[model samples]
Target: MDVTQVLRMKGGDGDYSYFNNSLLPRKVISMTKPIIEDALTNLYCDMNFPKTLIMADLGCSSGPNTLFVASELVKSIDKIRLELGNYDEPPEIQMYLNDLPNNDFNTIFHLVPNFQEKLKKQTTPNSSSPRCYISGVPGSFYSRLFLRKSIHFVYSSYSLMWLSQVPEMISTNKGNIYMSRTSPPSVIKAYQEQFQRDFTTFLKCRADEIVRGGRMVLTILGRQSDDPCSKECCYVWDLLATSLNDMVVEGLIEEEKVDSFNIPQYTPSPKEVSTEVEKEGSFMIDCVEVSKVNWDASTDHNVILFEEEVQGYNMGKCMRAVAEPLVLSHFGESVIEEVFERYTNNIKISMSKEKTELVNVTVSMTRNR
Candidate 1:
């Protein structure tokens, strides 16, 4: 499948839209705020606080999370200026929101006016907020999206795990949609090699665009273990594969279709990420952190439910918002609701036995001269 043509979150603010179901990503943004602030502060100081700042938020899906980074950066810079006694001369910002061509850019554009007004309200009477110029750039981040040496900083969250395309030789990865304990050795090797190639290309492209000493911060779903079949990385897909297999048995879908489909995502280990960065040789890794978030993280943690049904339903909706387009394109609209319904039941049963969590990795880097 041509992933660029199909990979996108469910659009709009409807019941199943990404905008309503993106609490997990929003939580991630909050969790990494310190790292993002540090990177921006260092970039601003190192660049001597340029009068104009240019930056991009890669894979900025249509949601409030799209502008969360921009807001944070502005607040950080404003605080820095206040401390340095330069609040009177606020910098101008050129912000780019980037994603695949199919993303819901209209929803994001509609929010811009309110975003600007919020910024205005935050400024003190004695000082003015920076004038932020926001524009949408539709494309894949695996390729160049900015002029050479033009960007001052870059940020992406929960995006890089998606390979540009599925591995060419994974046809033998039957019965599974991602790396699994039952998958053949060749399937695992194909995935690892694919990630190395795509990640290297990503660094090379960004190196050409970001100026020397520019900062970049990325967060992705990742595994702590070097083993590709580790539960942290592959278990969720396993559950999804199980859901499809159940449908196949009930004659709801063809086994052949299930055998041919594979998700175009890979959760690399921290070591894997460092290896690619070092091998690519364009950026230096400044910080790497690994954290665990419950699959039902968006729900209130203080409320302990005796029943797992609510948690399962929450997770099911979240995954559907992100994966529905891909599934819909492959299996047709008929199977979308049934497949997710089965997936939710599977999650409920599994959680009844034991809770599951996702492993997230955050990396901070700087463009080298």
Candidate 2:
């Protein structure tokens, strides 16, 4: 399947919806809150505050965290306004919640009234709060989504690791859905080149949308090691490929199908990200951090009792939420349960040995004036 057709979180508020199972991403959002706050505060101090503070959360899938971010940002801006005492009145806020066109926006919109009400209650009885307007901008973030020089701050969490589309014109790496150690040098190069192109495009587009001195805080799944084939970065896909190969051996799925399926994802190193930003020439990197999160951090169940089952089940569900749609799009939906069952077993065994983790890279950039 092509990148556009395959890339989306499992939709709806159902069992597999990102809303129901995106705990990892939700946690990442919380972890990055301090950075977001600091970036906003810095933006205000660096320039004359505007009447309407334009901001956007790119790749904001449908979930509670969507409105929660909006609420927190509005509050932070208000606090900064009061502390700085630069404006006569609190600035109004225009927040754009962005995501793919296929995202379940209804699920998010249903909660908007409550979000607005909460914001309203936070203000004093007589005093007015800053007017907050929330809207969804449905599209890919790799391209332009706003007017030139419009947005002041942009934030994306647990996104940007997703390539706009899978790399084109080569498929030597067989039986793997992503870049793996077994993948040839050509395949690795292809993936890296695609990332460079997509990320450069992303920075260029955001540069146009953001006003001079605007700031963006982005948190993405990344790799600490320079090699893309490192265990922390590519082991998940390796396990997935192993499961698919098992299916191939059992005649449940065709080997050719497995060979052709390439996941449109990339976990970049810190250097890779910084290089793109510098090459794009639109933004200067304010800060870049690479942190690690344990693979089982989101698993709250009793691991001692149902160690394998709990770990495997939780891991499967988490991955399914993010990749089920793509898997369904590529292979029929019928194979999803069986494939994940095998994947669960593999993860259960893998987790028993060494603790796996994900490296999260958060980059804060300011638009060059």
In order, what lDDT does every prediction score?
A: 0.88, 0.85
Q: List the residue pairs that clash in candidate 2.
A: none
TM-scores of all candidate predictions against the true structure: 0.96, 0.94
lDDT of 2 at 263: 84
| Per-residue lDDT of 171 in model 2 | 55
Q: Pick the candidate with the highest lDDT.
A: 1
Candidate 1's displacement at residue 335, Å, is 1.1
Quickly count the clashes in candidate 1.
0
lDDT by residue for model 1 (143-250), tens: 999999999899999999999998877357888888889888988888889999999999999999999999999999999998889998888889899999989999
Model 2 lDDT tens row, 38-130? 899999878677678899999888878788788888988877877777546778899999998888889889999999899888884445678
lDDT score, candidate 1: 0.88
- CA RMSD per model (angstroms): 1.8, 2.3
True lDDT of residue 55, candidate 1: 87
**Could you give me the TM-score of model 1 versus the true structure?**
0.96
